[model samples]
Target: MQDKYATLAPALDSPANEGFAITPSDSSDLQQVTRALYVGEGGDLAVEMRDGASLTFKDVPQGSILPLRVRKVLQQTTAAYLVGLC
Candidate 1:
């Protein structure tokens, strides 16, 4: 089946953490959940678990991507990428 990403996926964590600096090294484990980012030319972005349930930039705006510190652990977590509602 073709996995689909939602327009505004559920937020599992925030972006600004006190004692954390998370960064997705691969972004593979999150091949199931859809991320919350505005499609733009700022490079492809994927939602990630910074600490628990929040976002890096809350919303990816309309033409920007989340910073690396506020994303998933690449080969870890269970998030996904999205452009619109499938």
Candidate 2:
């Protein structure tokens, strides 16, 4: 039998806790985000996937980590702090 799903490649290096101000674009320069932990510092972060799906995080306190799979970030939104754990 064969696996139904393929495993993603391991990250070349450890994930760094970096701040990013995501903006929507038609550019395909987006990275292949396998997983990410949202670091609550600023306000809540809203995520939009490539499949036209959306997810919003509300009332997340500071230092909270929310794991999610993201294909792209929404445009013209508030700052969403996250630690990319790919």
Candidate 3:
């Protein structure tokens, strides 16, 4: 499963390949994500996708998708996001 989200580096490893990539779990879903907790935005996300195993966002005209089950797992444990941060 970890291999699936190759771009999602471990919290103790490297930052996400993309501006907003997954990091090792500092919260509940450690196995799914990485150091999203350390994000300058002050973490805390509400990922609703379970088996969806994929997340979506617009990189502009074209969109992108990421591993959801993994993302949700990490989001469960990350620090709560600060107000007005995202």
Q: Every model's Cα RMSD, please?
A: 14.6, 8.3, 13.9
- Prediction 2 TM-score vs. true: 0.51
Question: What lDDT score is found at residue 29 in candidate 1?
Answer: 36
Question: Residues 6-86, candidate 3, lDDT per residue (tens digit)?
Answer: 765455344344333344343443333322322323333444343534343222121222323333433352333211100
| Model 2 whole-model lDDT (C-alpha atoms) | 0.53
**What TM-score would you give candidate 3 relative to the actual structure?**
0.18
Provide the lDDT at 25 for model 2.
44
Q: Which one wins on TM-score?
A: 2
State the lDDT of candidate 1 residue by residue for 2-53, as single tens digits.
Answer: 4354344544353321232233555343333333332343333434554545
Query: Comparing candidate 2 with candidate 3, which one achieves the higher lDDT?
Result: 2
Arranged by lDDT, best first: 2, 1, 3
TM-score for every candidate vs. truth? 0.22, 0.51, 0.18
Native RMSD of candidate 3 (Å) = 13.9
Order of the predicted models by TM-score, top scorer first: 2, 1, 3
Between candidates 1 and 2, which one is better according to TM-score? 2
- Candidate 1 weakest ten by summed lDDT: 77-86
